[model samples]
Target: MSRTAVYNLPARWLHWAIFGLIALEFAIAWTMPDIHRDTRPVGLVAWHLGLGTFILSLMLLRLLWRGVSGVPDPHPGPAWQDRIARLTHALLYAGFIALPLLGWANASARGWTVHWAGWVPLPALAAHGAAWARPLGDVHQIVAYALLGLIALHVLAAAHHHFIVRDGVLRRMWSSSR
Candidate 1:
């Protein structure tokens, strides 16, 4: 088998950073009380929103970097498996962008302005108490759950490549240099 080139340092860092941020977002969400419009955001809720914004920004940057740097060569595998892998990656990227927009829309519908670190208020995406708030919130939750499943599948696939297949596919993303 041929050796696979590892991702560049910036790519590796962005990938890991986004992964850590997503974990932090989940932690904040699970621990914090539900934020309501009437109540000012404090503690975990504030951290959740702030971290989410940061994640979104980083994701955008990652996408830009990906576009400029391009991906490593495709892992040699069954054609079907390669297609499946591509689809999974696309969904993950879309989720990174979609989930936050959904959350932002939900917040806007609730008449709340998202502030990053207790300052730098973000613009509202919808009117206060908009008819779409509840629906958007519900969709956001559903997508989040789906994203969690996708992440699990992603990790499982990587493990399969590393352990069972004994392919260097996993190492491509694991290392910062070729």
Candidate 2:
């Protein structure tokens, strides 16, 4: 079968849905009270943890879907540009996976339980008061900042393709056309 020129409907939905979830994750994290071992998680902190688990699950599903369905053909561009694009996409996927795992590890190290929608409880990777908690939290923060930068770059590149380059690269993922 011939490869399509644009992403399939499921792919598009997954892309946008994940995007929204990531935004919500950031919003929750920023607005929520600081969660420490002594403090009980209530409002936004609980939402953050639950939403984070959901995002991780969605990321896994997105990766699986991409692997099974494959992606549209690369847009016509210089080899260097294409390589950069591929690298950017790789980093974004890595960030999606790494950020959540890092948060989970941090929570585990701090003796915090992460629940899925406050119903299903996830096991902690480390014991409470683990020495690694602080360091892991630091790493998580660093990675989160870097991921935000990468996202900005990705958005600017897509806008450049759509507006300046007019190459239809952005349209492939944005529109529902084959």
What are the runs in model 2 whose C-alpha is more than 4 Å off? none
* Candidate 2, run of 10 with poorest lDDT: 34-43
Please report, in order, the local distance difference test score of every candidate based on alpha carbons.
0.83, 0.84
Q: What tens digits encode model 1's per-residue C-alpha lDDT throughout 40-67? A: 5667777877888778888889999999
Error of 1 at 77 (Å): 0.7
Judging by lDDT against the true structure, name the best candidate: 2
Per-model tally of clashing residue pairs = 0, 0
Could you tell me which residue pairs clash in candidate 2?
none
- Tell me each candidate's TM-score: 0.91, 0.94
Q: How far out, in Å, is residue 10 in model 2?
A: 1.1
RMSD of each: 2.7, 1.4
Residue 131 CA displacement from its true place in model 1, Å: 1.0
